[model samples]
Target: MYCDESGFTGNDLLDQGSTYFAYASVAINHEEATEYVNNIIQKYKLQGGELKGRNLLKSTKGKKVIAEILSTFKDRIKVGVYHKKFNLACKFYEYIFEPPLSEKSSLFYQIKFHRFISNILYLDFVCRSEEAEKIFSDFQNLMRKKPNYLFSSSETPDMSPLDDIKTFCIHHRDTINQELNSLQGTDIGKWILELSTSALFSILCDWGKEFNQLKVFCDVSKPLKENKELFDVWIGIKDKIYFDFFQGVEEPITFNLSQEVQFVESDKFPGIQIADVAAAACAYAFKEGVNQNTESWIEHIPGMVIGKSVIPDESYTDPNTLDATRNLILLRYLAEKSINKQPLLDGIEEFLSAVTHDLNLNPSNRIATIAENSRSDAPYFNF
Candidate 1:
């Protein structure tokens, strides 16, 4: 597979102009990729040293070329797109919640909490909740290892950012709190915070599952190169990276990559160049939506997506959507799976029901007041 990325801001996900990050892997070998690019260039009669996505997006004809390219290669390409802020909120959920909850009830953690909690937190973030901002800020501060930094809850009781979700942390404060306090000092904490790193790992795993012996060629990236050894160890020996968190309750998963990813110049590789176009098209279309001319190219993208779309369709917390109702039901299921923990189970059911019923895209005056009080001194929208 050939890989390339667009809208990569490394660790600076929030401040970047690109609101979405995209990484694409094309399942075409070098010989076929070369022939395809050469044919397209001749057919379009374009001037080019390298068929860069940015340059192709500059003209009407170039866009048509992109459209044709996507139409022809749609089945072979897989693109992962993430809204930067939403992605950050997901990281926050994983870091703060996963450590404790995954340990307690692996089945529930795998089945529900990861998706449900992250979606809930994402809703809180886009709705402009003050607590979401504070939590996100604390996570950023923690990852960056700012001196004398403390979680918001440490200074003020009942003031930590999760709002309703904080109930679980409170119950398991000994374990959860220890993780929060010490995670910044660890390497995994720092690594998990990088969106590119996460996307790369996910997409590679996706490819690995599909093919038995895989060879991945990527555009030159320092971050991927730095993490190469770590990736190999994790992909080669899963137990080395993560405990058998699921155990026999869940089926074993495997990642197969025969050799280390070879980083090469995009100019020399046709496959990486095509992947560049796919990634760029996805990043732009998802971030800004589509115009009249580019809509054809955009239409073909969803089929190529491996999981969720670039932006989620439902406001996860709004009761008007079935998504909220589904989350409520999931909480009840969590209560079922939870072992002999009445208080925690009750808290889960109560918190999710209340939050789902109360939250909306637009907050009420009272909700706004809570938001105003909960936010950090700096504005949440700025990032």
Candidate 2:
């Protein structure tokens, strides 16, 4: 039950339509998971230098300070570097320290910098799930090929899972603070807080089996408001069935109701607005798809199950959407847990008919105008 969210927008608060938020929850077997991770960390450390106080991008030029620290550990600590744009220097300054630092600021800078780097490294490690083994292998191979540019680090000292997670959040908070001071006109702090919240949610989802049975629900809006008529069919069915099925459960269920609010000022649909909604929708869809197969008494029903529901105008086509769709269909066969699919399908059909009847009764109000101006210069693509 691990849930996490990522914002595509630079400023989550001020920047309205340009930002996107993505939330995901994954469940993984816990038996020996921590030990496995620790083992991986140890293996990484033994190849080179010591594990304590290592920087993420040590090999990068801007992080020469980090390189120096690692030099002490030598071959005892092994650092894994991802050679992308090599923007470590920019990110370092951007995520740590204010301008015009005096000699006295060295200690302050070091503390903040180490915490930030450690968290980033930890995240990079956690995100490497079995599904991403190929990507990790490829990345490792790339690092091997570019020997000079590759960076690596030893694992953090042993700690409980909760403690390690809290440490990660605290470091994230420090990094966000640094970003707030160095960058202008944005509430990066709030964004990080949201990320932390989302991350905690993901962690819970990952370990959901340990908790009492919980049902998680999410919404998928239409691409255009006018398409609401189409979207309503599915939404209506879901609402009816969900409420009917779990109207008064003793245990509370979790509902993740996310709506993409447009930030653009123009009457026409903005690219940013569409991108944001689309990203959130995809994240929700993917999580549902994955969990549908893995959790008993949990169902994964796509908005399409209701039929003709117009997704919000803010929703746009993205690779994640297709991935989510594919996963949902595959879950029927690949999931380790068994679910009662008949109720879900029956609910879908009933809701679809009811919604279709309602739409027909009010043709004029059925269409919704998502934007003040309908036309846009932006290119349109289907998800």
Which candidate number maximizes lDDT? 1
1-383 per-residue lDDT for model 1 (tens digits): 89898888766656557788888889998999999998898999979657788788889988998899899999889888888776776666666666655545554454345555666566666677766666666666655556523243343234322444544444444665576667554455555556665666667666655565667889998777766776675444433122243324322244666678789998799999999999988887887677876797999998877553334433444434434344544544443343234544345546556554655433343234334333243222111
Error of 2 at 55 (Å): 10
Q: Provide TM-scores for the models.
A: 0.73, 0.22
TM-score of 1: 0.73
Each prediction's whole-model lDDT (CA): 0.65, 0.27
Please estimate how well model 1 matches the true structure, expressed as its whole-model Cα lDDT: 0.65
Which candidate ranks first by TM-score, i.e. highest?
1
Estimate, for each residue in 1-383, the C-alpha lDDT of model 2 and write its tens digit.
21223333322221323222343332222233234334533545433222211222222331232233223222221111111111121122234322212333343233233223223333333344331233233333322232321112132412322123222323334343453445333333323222223323333222232433322222222122222232223221222112212224222113222222212221122222222222233333333444432232112223111111112221211112332122222222111121221222224335444544554564432222112111132122112
Cα-based RMSD of the predictions, in order? 7.6, 26.8
